[model samples]
Target chain A: EAEVAQSPRYKITEKSQAVAFWCDPISGHATLYWYRQILGQGPELLVQFQDESVVDDSQLPKDRFSAERLKGVDSTLKIQPAELGDSAMYLCASSSRLSYNEQFFGPGTRLTVL
Target chain B: SQQGEEDPQALSIQEGENATMNCSYKTSINNLQWYRQNSGRGLVHLILIRSNEREKHSGRLRVTLDTSKKSSSLLITASRAADTASYFCATVSDRGSTLGRLYFGRGTQLTVWP
Candidate 1:
């Protein structure tokens, strides 16, 4: 069904370690989004990309988190020196510019920091 | 900070019963979208209602938006066990520079017992 693809459905790491999650959006989608969902809470936007360019990242914690969509098709989100509070489900979503109303989400990478 | 908040954090109902969830947002939005996520799974887009549109329906799902009150509601008629999931409301703000960025609510967890 042309779903967004995410790798390493689950990840566990030490608090001070580094971790990365990858996502490949649906083909021809121009807008990509990264969101973080804490247990019992709604997902929050971490970053947004438009054709390889960042459109919004105000909510992203730049001191420890970084995200990139170099080709505008696939994206990578990284957290260096991860914290225990960072444990959550990292989600990726994409939508076509023509029909920006609906977003297709990936299975997500559940990150657990010890 | 999340832009929307959903009512009734959790709901339990029998199969074939109708389920309703409500959402309220803090700002003017271009559109409001509803999504469902099963346990440990990705989100599935259900329906989207534009700010100008008051109501929309898809199969057993119906959504209504009240722009004046900055609120929306989702009603699922003839619910089944398979309909058990967490439902979330996402809004695209009209004041944002990007048109596709979504701000989500905490979500409503629904359980449909057979």
Candidate 2:
């Protein structure tokens, strides 16, 4: 029953504003991920972290988006100057390297950019 | 740039019936995983098949992976109305820096009627 945790389950902001989402993964999970799910579409990886170090962030829009896992446990994703298209569900996932590659996902933070 | 593409965008079935979904990937994968998401909620990991595994079973769910064909199938037998959700397939690549990065498909919307 160790579930990934997310905060501020819902967020609404105007375009050009700043928004941030937080996620706490399962205990001892070494890999953490941030994903964005547009309405009616699957989640897409925005950034991945392995023990506080970024592993893959090719799909991340570095100009306006940033993510971090400072302690290698909990992570934060921020969208600065949020655009209308940034409205989506932001999800966090984690999996331990010692376990099978099955990821546990958090309830997610739904962002609405008006 | 999704690595997996799930077949049949939507499926409707009666309770107790079997539900099967297929996913095709574009590259060699270290593993393929299936996840379910209820409306407005986070994803729940359903099953994962590694590159070396062909088939796996958990309760009423049976997952088959054809690594040669870069495809995987998830079959849920004796489904219930609660099984109504969006199901997605995610792929982890065999290449560098992609082991923990999951590329996901658009997902299939399943509506199981009671």
User: Tens digit of lDDT per residue, candidate 2, span A1-114?
Assistant: 899999989999999999999999999999998999999889998999999999889899999999999999999999999999999999999999987378889999999999
- Which pairs of residues collide in model 2? none
Model 1 per-residue lDDT tens digits across residues B8-114? 99999999999999999988888999999999888999998999999999999999999999999999999999999999999988885577788889899999999
Estimate candidate 1's alpha-carbon lDDT, on a 0 to 1 scale.
0.93
DockQ of each: 0.89, 0.79
Interface RMSD values for all candidates: 0.8, 1.3
Strongest candidate by DockQ? 1
What's the residue-level lDDT of A7 in candidate 1?
Answer: 87
Candidate 2 docking class: medium
